[model samples]
Target: MLDDLFPILADPDFQKPGSGLMSFPAYVYVYPPDEEYAFREALPQLQERLRRPNVGQNSLAVNIYDALVEHLEEKTLGGRPLLDRILEQEEQDPEKVDRQVKRHARSEEFVEQVASRFSAFAQEEGGLDRSYVFVHGWGEVHPYLRASQFLDLMEPHLRGYKVVLFYPGTYDNGEFRLFGELSSGNVYRASCLNERLEA
Candidate 1:
C-alpha cells in the first residue's frame, strides 16, 4: 500500500544519501497495492497489541492477514511462495518438496543481502559517530533471523565507526539483545530505538 510506506519513505533522515533504506530496490519499497486503505480502521488495536508483552502466537489482526493475501495476489519472479505451493504439493511428490525447501533457503539469503545495505554510520558535526546498522526485519519471517546475523551483515559497512546492529526482535517486539551486547563493555555507542532515533 502506498500509505504504508509514506512514513518511512518521505522522511529525509531515512532517505538520506548514505543511510537510506530506500537506496536499494527503490521501487519495491513503494510497491503500490490497489485498493489501499488505512489499517487503523480495519485492524483496530493491532499496533497497540504489538507493543505489549506475552503477545500470544502473534495475534495478527485481520487487516494484516488481508494485506498479506493481497501481496500474494500479485506474484513476482519468485513464484507463488514456496510455502504456499509446497503445502499444496506435500502429498503429491516428496522429492519436489525438497526442491521447494531449497528455494526458500535461497530466498532468505537474498533477503539478508538486501537488509544489509540499509545499514551505515552517521556523521556528526565534530566527527564520525558510532557506526550503526538497521536491520528492518519486519513481517512474518523476520523474527527468526538473529541479531548476530544482522551484526555480521553490518560489519563491512561500519568503516571508521563501530558497528552497532539494530534488531527489532520477537515476532513484532523489541528485544534489544544486540544493543545490550554491543554496549556491555561500553565499547560501542549502541542505543535503543528512541535514543538512536533522537541521535
Candidate 2:
C-alpha cells in the first residue's frame, strides 16, 4: 500500500497545498496497527524519495514523538524537565500522571505550543510553497493526545502546505478509530490520503 502512496506524495500537482478536494491541506494516511514497525522502517525511504530533485519538491518528515519531547523537555519543573517530573510522578502515582498529561494535552495552551512548533518547522523547511511535511509517531502521543484534536488544531497551520499524518488506525468517512479500537472522534476537514490516491 505504501508503494502506491509514494508517487502521490512526490507529485506536487496532486498534493498541491490548499488546492485539493478538501478546503484544508492536511491528509491522514491510515494503516493497520500491526504494520507500525514496517511503516517506521519505510518512512525514511519514502522521505528520501520525495526529496529527490526529480520529485520537484522539498520534503520534511516530523516525528510527533521528537516534537513532543522537545516541547515538554523545555518545560521544567523544579530544575528538571517536565518529562522527568512526569516519569517520577508515574512511579508514585500512575493514574495522577495520566490525568495530568491528558488534561494538558487537551488544553488550548498545548495546542498553541504545537502550532508554534509546526510554524517553525514550516519556516525552517523553506516555507509551505516548497515543503511537503509527513508526520508520524502518533502512537507515542496516543491516549494523551488524539489525532482528531491534533488535526483540528493543525488545520489552520496546514493552509498553503501539504501535511500528511501517518495514522495507525482506521478512518471511515469522517470518524477516526485509533489503532482501529479507540474512537478519536470525527475529523471532518482532513481528507483521507488513501482515498485521494485511489481517486
Candidate 3:
C-alpha cells in the first residue's frame, strides 16, 4: 500500500518550492477507512524517508481532528465554548441550537480560522521549508467543516511545503466522496493537490 506513494514521495522536483508541477503545493492520498491503522503504523517510516533538514524537527503528520478539538477547548465563539453552548441549548431549544451551530460552524470565517490553526502545525520552528505535511482526520470533523473548505483556506499558507492530505474516501472522476457516503454529496474536487495516491 505504501509503495503507491513512492513515486511522488521520491520526486525531488515535487519537494522544491514553487516548482509549479501542480497548481497547488499539495497532494491527496486516498485510502480505505480500514487501512487507517496501517497508515498510522507506516507514518514514521514514511516521514523518515521524506525528512529534509530545512523542514524542522516536528512530526510530519497533523491530525486536523485533534487541532479542531484543541481550538474548541481553548477558544470560544460568541463569548462561550461552542460545544457548551450547543449542548446547553440542546434540551430546551434543539432546533434553534442546531441552527446556531450550523451558522457558526459553516461560516467562512470559522472555517478559515480552523484551517489557519491546522496549517500552523506544518510550519518549521523558525521559518518555512520544503517539507511534507501529512494531513488526516477529515472524518472526525465532517459536517461542521468540509475538507474542501479547509484545503482552500490552507493553500496560501502551504506554498512552501508538499502537503499530502490522507483522505479515507474514494476519488472518482474528479470528486472526492468522503467515507463512501454517496448520499451525502460530500464530493470535493480540489484543484490544489498535484497528484492522488490510492491504496
Residue range 1-199, candidate 3, lDDT tens digits: 5656756666666556466435566567777877878887877777765554543233367777776665555568788877776677789998897677556555566657755654565553744343566778877767655677666756665655666688877666667778866322433434323244432
| Higher-scoring candidate on lDDT, 2 or 3 | 2
Candidate 2: stretches off by over 4 Å:
125-129
What TM-score quantifies how close candidate 1 is to the native fold? Answer: 0.28
Residue lDDT tens for model 2, 37-60: 999888887776766667756667
Better by lDDT, candidate 3 or 1: 3
Best candidate (score: lDDT): 2
Range of the 10 consecutive residues with the lowest summed lDDT in candidate 1: 24-33
Query: Model 3, which residues run further than 4 Å from truth?
Result: 20-23, 52-59, 77-80, 90-129, 183-199
TM-score of each: 0.28, 0.87, 0.71
Higher-TM-score candidate among 1 and 2?
A: 2
RMSD of each: 14.2, 2.4, 4.2
Q: State the displacement of the C-alpha of residue 31, model 2, in Å, after optimal TM-score superposition.
A: 1.2
